[model samples]
Target: MSAEAPARPVGSPRRPGVKMALLAFCMLVFSVDYNIVYVALPEIGREVGFSAQSLQWVVSAYSVGLGGALLLGGRAVDRLGARRMLVLALALYALASTAGGLATEPGLLVAARVVQGLGGALLFPATLSLINTGFEEGPVRNRAYAVWGTAGASGAIIGSLVGGLLTDYLGWAWVFFVNVPLCVLAVAGCYAWLAPDARSGDSRAFDVHGALLATAASTLLVYGLINGPEAGWSSARTLTTIAVGLVLGVAFFAVEAKAADPLAPPRLFGYRGLLTAMLIIFVFQGAINTLHYLFFIQLQDVLGYSPLEAGLAFLPMSAVAMLGSGKLLPAVVKRWGVRGALFSGLTGVGASMIVLSLTMSTDTGFLPLLPAVLLWGLFAGMIYPAMFMAAGSDAAPDEQGVASGLTQTSAQIGGAVGMALLIAVANAGLDLNEGAANSVGDVVDGLRLSALTGGIAAVAGAFLAFRIKPPRAARQDGSATEAPPEPETVHSA
Candidate 1:
């Protein structure tokens, strides 16, 4: 009875699972590089004289570059085709990793990291876009995303362990080298599994103005935050960076508001639940990442664990993170609703951090910190995926990539900001100690201060949990039907 042939449902990509694994593997590489390097910093410093301030660059550079590019990367994939961009990104990743490994000078290594970050910025979002493209809508997409989310969390744990083994025995360079193989494998495997998806030419134009303003603002803000306490909070450079960052941020918003195709859609934030969820996630991701930095540094430096020993110390946290995130998260959400899980996770994480603040001692055994770490890991596992799911819950199908990008951008920027703030707090009120362990007392004090910041942030997250709505079932009987008013938009349950 129809005048025209039935409109086609978009064809699913061939061998989606293989493509998903390749993407997951790339995420593992980047995350491991990020988390693993923090633990290995002392070794790096000892090998080549690294001032405390200089050492922070090793971590911050990656964040700066990666955070700077993620938004545009999402847009780029949408236009350029996910497959093409992903291959290019992987090539860049391998090149940077190789360069990073070969560098002897700190400046060179840091520069390599900036390049590596660029590759990651492109790679991650493209991969996420591919996943959203490949998976069928509803339970299939949710489960695919859940698995994607789990790999990233588990990868952090895995990275720390692998990085420790590599750094301890093989040297820190090996940590970077490991990525090269994975990059090759990922590209080759992806070639076999992931063909190009349906292309939309709408995403073509690069937003140079948006990218520069956003990157400048993020970098300046981070630099100011990290440098301020040490440089005198009111120092000219510190003050200038923050001031310029504010101006750039204002410009960025203006540019987006007027641009025909904005990097960030203004209406996206109108989804009240998604916006709040992003903020809460930003706060907690920082809280969680910084704690890993504190715990491992203490374990190895004060408790006199070898890299191997430190790796062992973190095993339980990884295990708990896996159990909680992989197995418990979806089930919990199924029963309690999104708000309930968000509240439970925030409360648990905050309480756990508070409990951890009590457990700090340079000489304390791992047993003393076990319960706190376990709780921290479980809560973190619960928090991340729920928020990730929340971000796209109401997003239009075509816009899922953008939704994922904003969610990750919030995560990266939050991580950089929160980390700088917490570390500044740790650096505050410290008496200089010449020892590598830096006076066990100073270390303990810093850990406590960092934990305090995280605990406080988590407490705030609890109050924000009420904003999220539970997921709804997708419509089944397919047609050129109207897009449902994104099920989770204002869901009560």
Candidate 2:
């Protein structure tokens, strides 16, 4: 058994609230970047003289960088330290954002985005591990996750609005420039507020071979998924890339099984709650991304709303999400426990998707979609925090970083795959070659079909939520009776 590190002094005077706020802001920045460039895409393509087909590399580069490096980032947090990784990540974001804003050519901007994604890969798991390790388990941890989730959920909506406003007022470059000041502020705040990471003496070797294979596999998989929808799915390039990724993935597991100190220790997957939470996160992220993509299409293409108008239309739903996640979700978890809350949230989201599908029409406006949108916000708010809370339910301190990485990796892959499949469902009968010739009615039908498919997946997730087994140290009232002891080995279920 590995020797446990000495505990920190009891009743230390660190201010958790301030630290939490800083962490939440970091999450907000990461989430905002995911979609902020979308509104600026057309302007960017025109300014950089990108070919229509090649323009997508701006977004895909980030996805590829982030998806590929997440496992490495998570493992680094454990080997290095969260504070160290956090500062490094923010620095990368600052430098990359500056480069992106100043880029005169398409290749430069795309390269900048890929660097920004690498920064996010480091930032996300580091921030999450800090949250999971800093807060006490149960209610305190749950509430912290609520605050974190609220920021993250709201950022996606806010990104579009901010992107549209900035792209219109200050130009597309400002969208990238905006992140610089925020990243600098966050870096300053991290140093001022966060407690210094405790030094550890453990000398376990990192599995470099395993890390390379895993990164390569993830990069190829995400690249293929992102490319498959645009390039023909059956294209030889897509098929070959995806097949190679799967082979590398299989090889990664085989390497890890023999390594003395694996990059991703197999034991991390032994916890039933963590496994269940990862599954739920996968489905939840996928469904939510599908809903958001379809909604944007409906608002812009079908209803003919301007970018700004469509961005503004999300205000009500975003407001509801923030309120529900910050205040209501904790109470729900206390009353019903994590499992119950997750089940309820998934069911609600599933039903909301079905209702949303029914309401979407070429003749409809934003008002017609409000009820289902609000319903989605309320329920989705509950799911995000609960899923994370469940992920950390029984994790040891040393394992928190990789555990966070696992959940996030699941979310990233799930979102890509989910969006691709659901989008294919939505575009079923429409010939892209036909373009404007495909009637609005046909497009609406396709979107409705995709939404219904997402709804079915959510319902399936609701059923799977029951598989999570709460830790023995947790009370039925959603508070920890005591901190769980470090386990010598995480036994398989």
lDDT of 1 at 189: 68
Candidate 1 overall Cα lDDT vs. reference? 0.72
Judged by TM-score, which candidate is best? Answer: 2
The collision pairs in model 1 are none
TM-score of each: 0.87, 0.92
* lDDT over C-alpha atoms for residue 276 of model 1: 72
The residue pairs in collision within model 2 are none
Give the lowest summed-lDDT range of ten residues in model 1.
473-482
Candidate 1: residue 230 Cα off by (Å): 4.9
Q: Can you tell me which runs of candidate 2 are displaced by over 4 Å?
A: 1-13, 434-436, 470-493
Model 2 clash tally? Answer: 0
lDDT of 2: 0.83
